[model samples]
Target: MRASVELPATLPESLRVQLGQVLPNDPNLRRPASEAAGDGVLVRLGGHADYTTVTQKAALRACLRMPSGATLLIRMATGSGKSLIFQTATRWWREVSRDSLKPVSIVLVPTISLALDHERSSQAISGLETVRALTGDHSSEERNRVLLDFRQGNVPLLFVSPEMALGSLRESLRELSLPDQHPARPNAVRGKLAAVFIDEAHIVATWGRSFRPDLQRIPGLLRSLRAIDPEIRTVLLSATVDAETRELLRTGYVDRDGRWLEVAECMPRYEFDFVEHRFTDSISRDDEVLVLADVLPRPALLYTTEVEHAERLHQGLRRRGFERVRLFTGDTEPSERRRIVDDWRDGRVDLVIATSAFGMGIDQGDVRVVVHACLPESASRYYQEIGRAGRDGRQAFAVLCAAPDDFKLASRMAVGSTLTLDVAVERWLALLEGARRTEDDDPWSGMPQYRLDLRARGRHIANPRVGERNRVWNKSLLVQLQRYGALEIASSDDDSDGWVAVPRAGNDGLWDATTCKSFLTQIFGARAAEEERAREGIQAFKSAWRVRNDCRLRMIYHIVEAGAPELSACGRCAGCRRQQVAPPHHVATGGGGESLWPDSLSPPSATRLLELTETELARPVRWLDWLRGRGVEQIVVERRLASEIAALWSKVERDAGWVISWDLVETRSFRPMNVPTALVLSEKSGTELERLWRWGKRWNDRTHQVAWWVALRGTQIGTRSLQDEGAAGIQPPAHLPSEE
Candidate 1:
């Protein structure tokens, strides 16, 4: 008799091996995790006894088995054990290694506080030692000692900020790398290094182009490091890397042939309740604090955008008889910052009023309330800041207290001051002229000798805007120029407190007066447009703040998650809580002649239906059949949706042997039916769709159905209550795709 056995193929090879040892598998352990035995190999996790959740265990299994040169993007929500990936991967590498030839991992963080937090956390893990932080705060001797220890294989894990990792850290690695070709050779730097882990990797996209250009250099650093350590793996950890940022990282870091592991879990580990307190007048700051004092428990965090706000709040709380409150900000001395942080960690401080800088590296899991005195600049920032709370998997509150004018104030602070296109062009040309003056006489030399103080360069700007006066002029522009191959950033001069800029080789034409002006105009125009959109988005956020009939947590999730699946109403936020407390007695209605568009049939809901339609479109053979297979019933029960599915099915026909097409256009009077049409839109058809939608929904009652289609393309959307889309009446465009 011939018998065959099957085994779970997804398990990591090492874990599968261990499981096989324990279960003999009933003759079912057959498939390997990878073709190569060593590829998916996992070693026993030594001395670590905590039981991991299913999500964490799956992530760990994948990490242990991940191949060299592969990039893993882990987008688990906050408090979801993001740190465990590297922690366990380090142990696995160590256990798998022979002799003292252990693996070295570099963890790049955004702040010194985060580095220190990681260092402390790693020190607590068993079988892990020499966990050091190489930050600006370290003394020269200490930094050198850490590097020496790393070179000698005494240090296994080193944490550094993005600046140090890309600059000084890369320099140290290059200087210390052995002049050996083979990674198998003993004492070779390539053989010792295993992975480069980037914590909070989303900054690469969010801040890389602007204030923190060093973040963009991470790809270059990873490329160079991987050249030395051919098997070097890149792991990016973040709680809030949006879709755009993920695409940017993928293109920047992952090679075409390499595997980019995307392990994303947006589900919340703890229940979160969001409360928005909008002030009618600016005088409500005191009232906001008083309300918070009454509502929130002790050991809460209050986040402010400015240091002045932190100070004012701290003083107000102190006067209000809150004794354990402390203040932390950029202005705080290093020693005082450390003491305040330590006090908070040791439970000595009950309430801490701090600027945005206070929460990044903090690991206090028991923080019950996180109050934002001002609106956060972006949804991502808001999510991350509030994530500091509820780490202990308990109920937590994320409170936002904003005044009527706060939206305007936040937008100004968020967008910062920008130079007009013409002003920016003038500055670019002037900088280019300065570089020209500093160039060497030697024909081969393209480097500049002049170094101007960044502040002084800003001072030279004529009639700068209010916010631009104190801002660095070329902070972002110089980086853009460098990226465009128009210039290079020569070393930063500490004595001059500025950076030297040089023209790139074979790029002198780019600095011509006309070309320079054109480049600046184009770049600055794009920047201004992006800033304007951000301002608009902030305004929308303010409007969303006034919303009281929907779930606030779900709204936030929709904002941050972007294109991910829409989550159902959490029914736990302030809005939901209020609804629970006082159920609406009756919803107002109009007369019989008045249109009563069902809440479930709104344009937003129509967009959701279109998303489902697209999913069915993926398999066109049974496209119509799948639509009729209770797709709408899964989300909501609507007879109109069922009828719409039947109508769409009638329109679908075999275009090719395996392909199908659906005709969506109807040249008739628009009815008040919640029918969604699936169309085979092309480059030209998109315009026609827009034209038809505008024509059909031209009346004031129906603003525009086409606008809904555009809004659904990006951003996570929540299910909104049915709003009036007016009774459809007008005739559609003379030519749609079907008509054409």
Candidate 2:
């Protein structure tokens, strides 16, 4: 008769070898709590006499036998051992469970920093193979290897960002590869993914609420994961989220019932502390990014929404005679980001001019400060951004400066985010230019399409847009370009929108790219030609992020963060350096409309508003009218969205202010392009006015262009509510007394 033995289903054979002393039923017999080295691995947690509350023991055990749990959501503070739970779970599957192949797993992270961090953490455990990170951070060849390895069961652990993992998984796979020497492993990837770990799972739903459409694809992505990978496992992790999001992730992705599964089969071990601040006009000095110079002793980081702010602070610091200052931003290359991180870790640079992309998976442990010169878009984002502070159980500082208009700008950006097919390619090319190889007969084609050769020229690409292809440069370029007197992004088509020429004097790219053979391989040699051109195009838009309006800081914050930074400045009353929470401010705004168009549906008020605008405010913003008005309003009384036009307006209006400088609004802000006295508005700007009144040429002139669209939208929308009082259709919707 076969030996009578029992084993759980999740574990596989290769992992079965390390099983003997694994299932310690004698809870007290677990590893001693004192020497419990949770480093690199989340070990010796929640079972012994002195098993501290720090391990979240009981909660984890309860999840193991949960009746309706099929998914796990670990909502812990930033710096918390969120990933440890996963590492532990992976180990458990290897040591105790029984199955065929290693309980194959996939780890999906939101950023490369997190990916690398997880890679290190996951690899520390024994019997874990095929552990690789799939991100914009890797080379085309590296990513190809990762995808191929996972497909052929060569890699047991795979980490990736939601963007690549969901939207371009197929494309990424098509680009799969292996080293040339390994002929035995030709074409070995197809339908072999066990479980998927959705790090930063909040994007699955939160992005929609905040206006990030790239995130809109998330819900479907989750469903598709299950469909695509037969036995895919999912582990979602985030900190400081609301119950609604929790419910959404759990119900929408994991479990059918109200319960959430445990990913590491471990409890949440986190301690949260919200430290606030208040600042005033006195906080910022003229000619200075050094607004807040003093930093905590611990390895702290400063998160500024705008690079202008960062530049200003950096310049100010220089003026203040501080040297070890190093700034990290989208403009900086990956290698630079890595170098800066390493240098600071090694006590080389004192401060880094960091953008949002600066701190994703950084385990600086003792990060003392996280300053927000501008506000983030939401409470959720704020928590995530500031969570970067205080990792090593040491005190950390998170300072947020509140400005009233921040929210509107942030909302506009949140609503407009989408993965432009062409834009993604453009970013890839720009990175390739610096890495060009002259030795190849087909120089351009030799350019690597997927690899981040961009990282090689770290100093040249200092602080590249975080997430490179993930999400950076939307704002930093705008702010920095403005400071450099570069042309504004949202300008006449003839002008260079994203074209950033190498500085004739200090530009390192010229020397790097034109140098020797070694330099080529170190930078752009691997990228394909098609990809090189895409970079040039994306380079054009990089400067466009900071278009401006009355809501300057808000827009700047929005464009830079990519997700609106919340208006902690509520009404400009909540000051960070001081400690004051003010009520939310507003422009005293309201609008109406039902079905703004004929074919489209809209909120009853919106549609009715559209009808009124036909005679009241006069012409509509567009044929789409109520369907896509407000530039950023995703919900026009229920209709999801019918037009990208409305989205573009909101995006430019919201983000330009933050990323673009105020100088760009009224005049060309750089040399050669003399500072003009007047500005030009798009022709569509005047459409909000009644057709009859539009006959007047004043609004059409470039001089009065700025007010054209504002008046149009204001009048058309302002007159919406008063349509019923139109006095038998005699007078058209006149500009309201205050607005006119």
Candidate 3:
């Protein structure tokens, strides 16, 4: 029998059906590709034995057929061949256009680590030595040679960070491909540049606000590149992008003239289960580590929100006898980063504790577990990190251990100002004014310098700790300041502790103090609003996380794809399994429990009513289970009727804080605010039904919203009639009701 066939009965019935449909006896969910088109390339990826997912095949085929000047976004699940999509697409593009030598693809990544990871993967393939990465680490001579080759159009696939691409690369490419110097290298600039791929595309949205200011230059750079290759294709890829983020990418990156295609395929084969445990103030890191040691499988990954935590956790695990564990973070030397990653992939290291820096662009199969030592900044990050496990069509676990304060801390981190925005504005204006005061400070004498003690300034503005400005915020403000054309930054080197820059007397309409102030106000104001909204969203997400009792997988799904069709519980999660093992002690029994509550009671507060109606209504099944488990005997309610109650609950909650529970309803009491509890009435005796109807009518008459009703057999849950009063209790109020 298949593993899915034995799904625990505790899972909601609807989810069980969906899981059964998708999860078959064969756990490997690869759909066989029609052996046409890119099958040749597929056979050569890693070897003929390399398994390609259906999504990869589809993406490859689409890339092959993508028209010139088109834009494509591939949002495949993490660890599900996102890099392969670009790799295969690049190869296929090269194969089809084998005739031209001019640069065909320019891949833009966010970090040097990602660029290296891509280069290594590409070099493994026989024909992909042409796949090279351009970075500052390359010697000037080597960089010149690569650029010269690229100008002469020899390099086919090149990977580069945004910094190199927008800075030195653009400068060198312009110098090499000077229209006057084209005859100097006829073989170089032959064919037009074909496509530009942006891997880890989510960064364009997430980091565009601050971390990597150069990312914001991508759109403008692409526009300039279009002048060279009018038909150049653009591809953006990421493992985690919510609908809101995807829309942002379109508006911010993909220009209006470009044709857009989206390739999204759900992750299959892997059965992901999530378990969360809370640590209290009394629990130590050692205690948390021990709990993990007991439950975690070999080849696990532990994620921390900060690098220092990663360091401490790594040491703690080793002390607890998990010596196979190692650490990977931005602090690790480049050479060490490579070694640790290679060792982890080879099973030489059983585990690695790292921050967000480690996961992207690396794929390790057979990972059995992933643990989040701290709560992630957002559900998107949480989901992507967990995706690392279960890539090999096997069952895996993702455990998140959080303390009470973790949510607020994460929220503050998510929304907190990296630097004092007002201080940054002040500094930029002061520096520019200083430059203006220098009589001989020829605007053309090249970029000026700002000997800023950012560390000191960071402390002065917000009393920020050491490394806060570098790690958290304010670096991007310089970039924005430069864009205002007042202070043009030449370079930011660690040796200087500040940045070298020039004051631009705006060749594009001279920068004056007034214009600079206007730009600063507008830019800073927008950033302030963005931070405000992000904080609100983070807080809401934290609230949702605590209240979530259904499938952890489903919660992630909803967060990622809001308004996505409801998915049933995965029956494999800790919650589902708990319900299955612990049989109820006192289920609502079938006979005369109608007049169970006293007649005289105070009306419920608006908050209590809304809580019972709206807050509890979102999950109809849970509420039904709650009713059944509680001592409400002979209860009867339809799913649709329950949903209406839930919708009404929202309105009530908005007007009044909501509350719902048997204890609260009876003790705190509300005459006109009762939320009817639901129960299955199909198998009930006629006498039982009569008793429930009599009780329900009494409850309905007293409340503004009607009480429960027997859901008729053959009637759909959401489409049941409210007029069927003869069958059960008084008809429930619809979200929009009239005199019916």
Candidate 4:
């Protein structure tokens, strides 16, 4: 018997038939859990220590072992200890790194409410007393004090929103990355810029493309930091990262040459009894919600898609004698948002009528009911909203009272926000025409950079608010172009008035009509694909509501979990109740049954092979000097060796160049620069090496400045093979030991 399944005697016939098709004869739904006691890590947590799960221990170990220039993706279920990963890691770093200046980490969240929630929760935890949330609610003096504490290393963990990360705090972050920055204490070296954690990372793919473009620019900020210190890490924490969201994150957040690792516990939430209803129109839906509000459960959340609708619904509920309900939306003032969250936590408010703005990382344990007054835009959103309930290991209810018009509204919202290719191109050209070349332009480099006015409008537009609308469209166009490898945005002003950018080396063809059209077509196609996926997700939710032949939980699991083999009909949903089966005993827990860092998988090696020297092999610094002296524009090495070499080169030459992977090169998604670059190769297979060699030859033929260095262990090949391809190779010292 697997940990995920416990058979109930005398199941209903409908559930029995459905479970027979999905579950194997002897199902093994979970990986073996960890047996090692987490006493060492827990003891360090002081008062916050509790019984740690296998998944939590594994994630913590992986986070602690994470090296510089690496990206880690954690996809656990909601209510699991995702926040503990950063909290513990920050404290552990401060304790281990014995120095006058301690390390600091920045956590970027999606909403101010989540930030405040974290700030409030940290008050009870040891070593996190100094954690602060910097949002618009703070006065200028308070914000400056927080920044001063951060600069002086008094604040170990800082919570902020993406808008502040790229805006007011941008210069301070850049300063932290500089290697020569003076330490606050005399004769003490400055502390390292530890890591950047993005909570609710799924938004980078969802909301980042449309309303909040700053999420997409986070990678650009990281690149700037890596240029100075190549070892700074990036950690993405989320409860749900589906296939599409995972792909977007890989291309946008993960470095082409750095390591990318994922830890997942993909168990669906099973503590909720689901019930859905469809009404003829808004009046009927309101009536049904009012009726359910009186009888369903206390401490509930009523979700709608629009702010006006949420406000109206809240007023209607209040008018009908529901005095404990409140409204929360994007337009809610910062002070009011804080009050609502505090009130909800303190048991002063029983219900919150909110849009998606109230979602993402708001942790409340006793929420018993979650009602949706309208349909969500996608399956992920719907799942996330409902996950707010049933988190206390108790039976909860999820009710959906939606109308027919929600389908059209959802479809329109999904497809209408994206700009057309024609509009994007028009905005791009307008911005270019209005752009002014910066004073630091190098004449011989052939890469002319300019600072464009984001407020520049197309000549045909004559609206009174053209400036604001044009600024938004301009930023959106820049984000799309950068994603497509057409341009590289260097930086932007806090006021959102202008940004500095340069066209990629090989992307000069973007100025040509045919080439530009073809390139923009690919970019627009990606957006269209996202919209289509969203529509499919909406349709799946609709099927779960309208089709009653199967379990509604099974339909949702197929959409959210996708390929997980664990499939059993949760006997508590409305469909099972209709078949005359009583709800079974189930307790919702936060952890999963999988071991973190499994034995079958090898963790990334921490050995620094570049430090080894032999009589026959030159020193790593000498090798870098030789390549730079020869004016080699690019160097190729294996992926595992690329990070060490990059760090060494950054230290020796004071120039941390880009590391392009074979995957990114193959997809043409990397930015091409005239400066020296390194390309990572695969050393495990001969077929892959040959393909890489052939691609390198073709690339050299076009670029005319290519160099290759292969890190060979014991294998020997003819030197003529290298000369034949106009490349160079390097072998390890004969006495060097192989990596374990």
Candidate 5:
């Protein structure tokens, strides 16, 4: 009784008909109720208003049939209420399987971030029972208590991160039997293994391919679960995934002969808008920074290429006096992450300058923008990140800062964790039957590699020609040969060349003979095609990066169109032509001329300032150039920014004497330079504006202008109270709600 068995009734005919429009397939209806004397139970697929949408309902019904073998994908983007769906599905399972012998559900999220978010969300949706989480980071005693509760069906919803699930399951099995025997259990080694939901399922391929070595052993784990219980239901969920990912799920999980499961596909809402901009040389770099600032100022995100840049930009913005900027990166402490999440949800921070480590699953319903300081290695990642925006169904922007070097960097990462074909073959072959053997050389059990070499040496690949290419190919061949059992040649003359695997003492009758053969043929044969597809999948991602810049849009468009769009857009995208590009210095209308940071430097933004230079803009420019030991130095010596960055400074200035030109710079000469600003927002008539110098909406500085306008209607309030007379009918600070 190791496995949890859930006996759910099939979808009703009328419900099935309605669900058919949205859910995939008619669904596996329950067999007639058992011939018990008691009354039979009735169940409905999805009872939500939005489930009326085909994809939403389909995905829900499919969840009940977890362990579907194929990876299940749910692409609702960010803020689409994925937590809502999980909540509803879990509740539905509870209702449908309560009377059954086994508890019906277990949810496995990918990261602690998602776990925390899900835990709170589940409670908001249903409070029938307390929903608890089990994390390895918890104390041993705490973990034991949680596990005890889960094993006994004391908790209806058990939310856990993937790492926690793996460790917990392993520990549970260890307590039941030895490590090796764990997988051979009758069911998941527990009588309550009803359903398991794997959140962020894409990690099974992405991150799982790297640091999480245990992920590669997941298929085996799943097998063990089934061995313990045949009726265990497993669900895989991801808000964003690609066709390659979908295929990988199919071959690696579902299509395995060890498990006979079905699959259901759900579509995504709207084709995503993907674009990139250069970061260095020319105004593109400035444009990108401004774009991010503009987009983020409207409850958006600002991204940076590196930690140094993040720190620098964060400091710079604070000094420029933007009190609403929040910085988040890998370096941010967990306590800080929680705080940042709170601010975003509460609307305190207008934007977060974060690294990729930010926002895996912190749901902020009104994210209006996602700015990438660097281009992501793949569009899959791009899609996932951009999903954070428009959670409330408002328009949003996804901007990529694609400098010349940015592409190369992203390209480098594209091949980052990829394994060469040779390496792949060798690793797989090394894990073959013979190589998995115990060594006789040692008294105690251990693996033997010499026998594998001997068998490989006799193969055709052992006889190689010349050239590096051939050498690589030969290595691949050796790897391929190990697919089957080997080691016919025993070191001693008396033994046969190949040795058969020694079965466990009592496992002689483990699997039915015919059943074993069928599984073997099905798995090995199907795996061949899967391997080929994986190779191609990797190749396609690599090729997309090489596409010409002009043609790059097509690759993006192709991916967007290929994924079914289930949600309609609210326009305002480059695709939707909401804004037009302006002439140089003329500014772009799509996003107010990217100057979001020039208004006023906040305290943190000025950390680099040495007494805040007050110099003739031209002389300071020359000194700056001199320091760069580059062209800017000569200009500084000759004097250039004298009129710009110089004027913005107050005296006590470093190199020269200058006046605080808040008003002067606001009215005169200008150029794009990276600066941070503390935007004090206001409304004039119908337009929302930020006082760059304490007053007026200057469209000349794009990012700020864009940021001001977008955030206005969204119900935003400035950090400080200003004269109410500046704008007609603008709410006074008293009427303004605090920015979250």
Candidate 6:
């Protein structure tokens, strides 16, 4: 039986030995058919035999039933079918709304390669042939064609970079919210925009500050979209989202009065066998790379921190008779980059010497090795990049070669683009002056808006050739202010000369020195602390790679999965090999958990919810108006009803000043609310009613002067009645009543 076990011929001999001991004796360890059944949407979209993990099923169900203004963050492991969630949702929407209004979705990617990759893969999926990637690489004709199709409701899945999203696609996106008349039939509605997906979402927090400020502007785009259609949903997808990134996303994307659901399977990849090496100098590292190039597995990726290094390595490997090696970097031309990706995927290229520009969302599954020639800037980046390997569920290897200078380079890269407080203030003042000259106030919000010049120079700057640098700093300042809720950037033009923005209400005094100073200090201080944390993370990674006594994979996982329980030592790692520990017979690869929603209680279809009659909608609208008239500042409802009510309330009140929270009886933290707020509890569960009762008593004890009110969903709370307390009984909408 052992001799008969078959493995892929492409796998390396060493990996073969490691995997040989782990091959299960029962070759057919598949789950029973009954246990492997999938959701109807998944089965229809994927196949009858398709099996999905619990996390994927839950996320898909949520997506299908996602309410307006809600944000869903999915942090699943690489190769875990994260893309399936959005694909299924998009197709499901198309199927359900084919005869009515067809809805479209936009997928924002970090790089052009990723956009093109998605577009190519989407062509094979059913009901997604209209998918198109609109990027600068396309000719004007191609872009116009894509735009025409999008405007006609022909394009269903559109892929674009952040730049295109802010530039040419801005108007088209906004037009999605406006009702369109059908060309063929009178009084017929055409299409509506349903969702926006941000792929590789971690970049919004990590790279948006400096490298691509447009990523940070995405929330502003969503704000504009929601202003028109309050029911549009936003989905953020990534393989890793650290605490800082998660917090940034919450502040930027999640609506204050809406619901936030995070679906995460925070576990390290167990398929990788890690190997670490430290060199005394570049000369030694180069020689070592040459030696390993011959012995390392084929279809490998060698990463460098800079373009020059990648070019040099490519040349050296080619000179040493490696004919199938290629170079890819930021400077690579658009056509060549596409060609490289194609060749790499088609097995024409055996090795790729590249910077961070390549291999994001690339779906080559048989890659066996990922060699890092230099230290990455952060642990998240390191993990994301190395995840390019072992995607086929086979054994793979991660080789790290670091030098002393690499650490310095990584530290410098981490803290290079942050601005000082004084400089930020100067830049802001200069931009504000330019905006005053433009005098472009927004018509909708009635706030003073402007198209501030990105190239504006401060009085202290004498150099005339630093316009580009000035533009970067100006955009960075604007992004920081926007993230802090000081302003909103409405849009930008293709020339990239300026961005239209307006001061958020109550922040109109941002031009005042005292107020400006206070705000800038908070932004700068938080940025400084973030930089410090990044530096510490870099140091920790360096320390982990330097120490050879411990399992490198475990140390790396600890850094990336902060506060996670210690994982079992990988038996194939260097430390385990030194200790001669036997490899495990099998390893679990995908996420594991029960479905968030049971089959019997599946959520109502988005179509059904959106089709509420005027009378049905008016009931919730009237309830919200009454609450507003009563000066209710805080609204507490069960998790199920919060989203529906919040959507209704947003339509009536645009400011979102009221705070909406869940009544799940869990310990949670909240931002301080200082207004003369009225708390309205709309709960039906007995346990939650008791919890709110205890909460109201504590609130009265703390604030003796403030008055609070209770709004019960029903008259009875378990065995007790609230009729004597003068509390009002507010029933939920007739269409969506409390599930007592």
Task: Specify the highest-lDDT model's number.
Answer: 6
- How high is the lDDT of residue 189 in model 5? 32
Superior candidate under lDDT, 1 versus 4 = 4
Q: lDDT tens string, model 1, 536-633?
A: 65666665666877766666666665455655555546566657633222211111111122324434233322322343333333534443342321
Candidate achieving the largest TM-score: 6
Cα lDDT of candidate 1 equals 0.55
Candidate 3 structure quality by residue, lDDT tens digits, 336-439: 77677678766898888888877676677677778887888777677777877877656666777777667777876676444465666565554445432222
lDDT score for candidate 2 against the true structure: 0.38
What are the clashing pairs of model 4? 68-231
RMSD of each: 21.1, 26.1, 20.4, 14.0, 28.5, 12.3
Model 6 lDDT per residue over 1-740, tens place:
13235655544454445445433332332111111224335555543223344445446656765666689888776766777777777877777664466788899998877887888888778778788888677899988988878766788889888888877887777777765552432232245788999999988877885667778889878877776777788999988787778888888788645577776656677677676667778767766676667766768999999899899888889889998988889898888888888888789998999999998878788787889989998887898898998776666668887777888899988766767888888877787777742455555467776788888888878998988877877877888888767887766554668887877888756766457777778767777777888888888887776675667667777777533565766676666766776555554333323213121321211110011333433355555555456445435444444445555554442223233344221333221132334444454446766676666545444443123344543434457554433333222222333326
**Candidate 3 Cα errors over 4 Å, as ranges:** 1-54, 98-100, 111-113, 134-155, 172-192, 266-270, 416-475, 478-525, 562-565, 578-740
* Candidate 4: segments with Cα more than 4 A from true spot: 1-36, 46-52, 180-192, 434-451, 462-465, 502-506, 511-514, 578-740
TM-scores for all candidates: the values are 0.62, 0.45, 0.61, 0.72, 0.52, 0.73
Listed per model in order, the count of residue pairs whose N, CA or C atoms clash below 3 Å is 2, 91, 19, 1, 75, 0
What tens-digit string does per-residue lDDT give for candidate 4 at 23-141?
Answer: 23222212222222232344455233232344564466567656666888887777766888888778777767765566888999999889999888876688889999998989999
Q: Give one digit per residue, the lDDT tens place, for model 5 in 92-154.
A: 555555343335356776555566566665665433246676654567787777767655555
The lowest-lDDT stretch of 10 consecutive residues in candidate 5 is: 33-42
Q: What is the C-alpha lDDT of each candidate?
A: 0.55, 0.38, 0.54, 0.66, 0.42, 0.67
Given candidate 6, what's the lDDT at residue 138?
84
Q: What's the lDDT for residue 585 in model 4?
A: 43
State the lDDT at 356 in candidate 3.
81
Candidate 1 lands at a TM-score of 0.62
Model 1 poorest 10 in a row by lDDT: 30-39
Model 1 regions more than 4 Å off: 1-43, 46-51, 97-102, 176-191, 209-213, 223-231, 256-259, 417-420, 423-475, 481-516, 578-740
